[model samples]
Target: MSDAPGPDQAGPQTQLPDPPRPPLPPTAPERGGPRARLLGIAGLVLTVLFLPAGLVLSIAALVTGVRSRKRARRVLAPAPGAVAGIVLAVISLVLALSQITLYAIAWDDLNGYVTCRESALTIDDKKTCQDEYLPRIEHRFHLPKGSLRQDPSWP
Candidate 1:
């Protein structure tokens, strides 16, 4: 055989370069803190448990999560996982809070003085009750006489 190899005899070229790998995206949620994510989950859990107070926390968590996501997108590649987590948490929180708020309002409308009475029923009840009760429990804490009005439906 000749010194030069035949086509069939030639092996595949060893010099071929490897195909480049695509770069992976970076991960960073906007606002650079865990606060939004943490608050979101905590708010959701609390909302499920404590209701009224949780509702406030849920609102806070939703607002913060939204702000954080918007901010994170502006600064770097958005962390989709974190965003999703935040969204789920926030939604859970809002739903929880809304449910509780609705229940409270319904309770108020259906049982005019029950909330007030419950507030004043026992010394132990007073300690555990909400501040909203402050206005009803004590004679000194009265709404302005003209403040009473027809119950307004929520929009």
Candidate 2:
């Protein structure tokens, strides 16, 4: 006589209750403690500094902040300052490498000039060899091979 089906025919109510709510999202950093804020700030700054030492410090600060925030049940956010520090460090390294590359290019040119002169001298073109090569090598390196037979001086 009941309109609803009995348990055997109901098929477990067809609709489930809402799943238990997920843990609430953390509130923003303003809700965190002073120490957490400081760690975040420090991490951001060190990352910007870009130096090897700065990078190390920045990483430490970031780790500290993350740990502290987790313990405090606060929201954690990446600091812009730390990101800048990391960028700076990378740029500095790149610049150093570029400078080295330029110096290597110049050095190679100088070596080529010296080698050409040595070849000329081997063919008894002493005047051409000395005029084109010797002074430059002596001025730059402060020494030149005295005898080709004994010193190849490729390096």
The 0-to-1 C-alpha lDDT of every candidate, in the order given, reads: 0.58, 0.49
lDDT of 2 by residue, 79-114 (tens): 323333334434444544554565575575566666
List the candidates' TM-scores in order.
Answer: 0.42, 0.25
What lDDT is obtained when candidate 1 is compared to the true structure? Answer: 0.58
Q: Which 10 successive residues of model 2 have the least lDDT summed?
A: 78-87
Candidate 1 residues 74-122, lDDT tens each? 8764544456546756687658857866566556443544554455767
Tell me how far the alpha carbon of residue 24 in candidate 1 is from the true structure, in angstroms, after superposition: 18
Which has the greatest TM-score? 1
Lowest summed-lDDT stretch of 10 residues in model 1? 146-155
* Prediction 1 TM-score vs. true: 0.42
Off by over 4 Å in 1: 1-33, 80-82, 101-105, 108-155
